[model samples]
Target: MAEIAVVAISVAKPGHEELLREALEGIVGPTRKEAGVLQYDLHRDVQEPRRFVFVERWESQDALAAHAQSAHIQAYKKAAADWIEHAEIRVVSKIA
Candidate 1:
């Protein structure tokens, strides 16, 4: 199966930027250790400090699905729910 790339964008609620950031950062180390995870990186917007993006690459769609079900991800979702105002995830395929 072809690899999959995911772009996850999260917007923190006002006054909760640092809290959200910390929660997001906590997932990085554990997520990177998961099977089939090619890359897992987090980025914060320079102008919009409350916005965070996670760029991830997986070996396959199944791998990505497994990642979604992982404990760390579930924990992140629960922990971030209160602090995040908006969240979006896009799974894309490479064209070139």
Candidate 2:
């Protein structure tokens, strides 16, 4: 179980920025309310609007798995599917 996860997502579509933002923004509330999530932050690329990064902390890998199956996350996925160019997700154990 990873205690932390750093997700680097890149959306390739030129016109899908709004969709991506909506999807990312939509999941924030639900993720914050989740029991497993300790912290979550979304970063948008200033130079490249298509690139986005999500830094997330969880109690454990189990918690992360739970987040993956969350309804809000699912809905966001659906909404942003067409706009997603690629998703690069990585889970890492917290050192601290």
Candidate 3:
């Protein structure tokens, strides 16, 4: 089995927590249902309203690459177009 871990940190527009949550729901929901996905989770900081994180595990790099091409992911990008301030995504391999 292949494992892929990712962290996405993003800052959204002020008063956009609800919007961000909706976007995240779209992301997490579909991502979890992805063919190669094993885990997908969302996180938020209690003290930080605009900060969000997503943790995902896929079957392989090819699976992750396929996730990038999904229509829902595209919609997520479009829905978050102007609201997202900055995003940092990382793909990691766990140490055995």
Instruction: Report lDDT (CA) for all predictions.
Output: 0.96, 0.81, 0.85
What stretches of model 2 exceed 4 Å from their correct place? none
Q: For model 1, name the residue pairs that clash.
A: none
Tens-place lDDT digits, model 3, residues 1-96: 468788778888887878987888777877788898888889887898788888888889999999999999998898897888778899999997
lDDT of 1 by residue, 1-96 (tens): 999899999999999999999999999999999999999999999999999999999999999999999999999998889999999999999999
Lowest lDDT block of 10, candidate 1 = 71-80
Best prediction by lDDT: 1
Write the candidate numbers in order of decreasing lDDT.
Answer: 1, 3, 2
Ranking by TM-score: 1, 3, 2
Worst 10 residues of 2 by lDDT: 1-10
Candidate 1, lDDT over the whole model: 0.96
Question: Least accurate stretch of 10 residues (summed lDDT) in model 3?
Answer: 1-10
Q: Find the candidate with the highest TM-score and give its number.
A: 1
TM-score computed on alpha carbons, candidate 3? 0.90
Displacement of the residue 43 alpha carbon in candidate 3, Å = 0.9
Candidate 1 global TM-score:
0.98
How accurate locally is residue 72 in candidate 3, as Cα lDDT from 0 to 100? Answer: 94
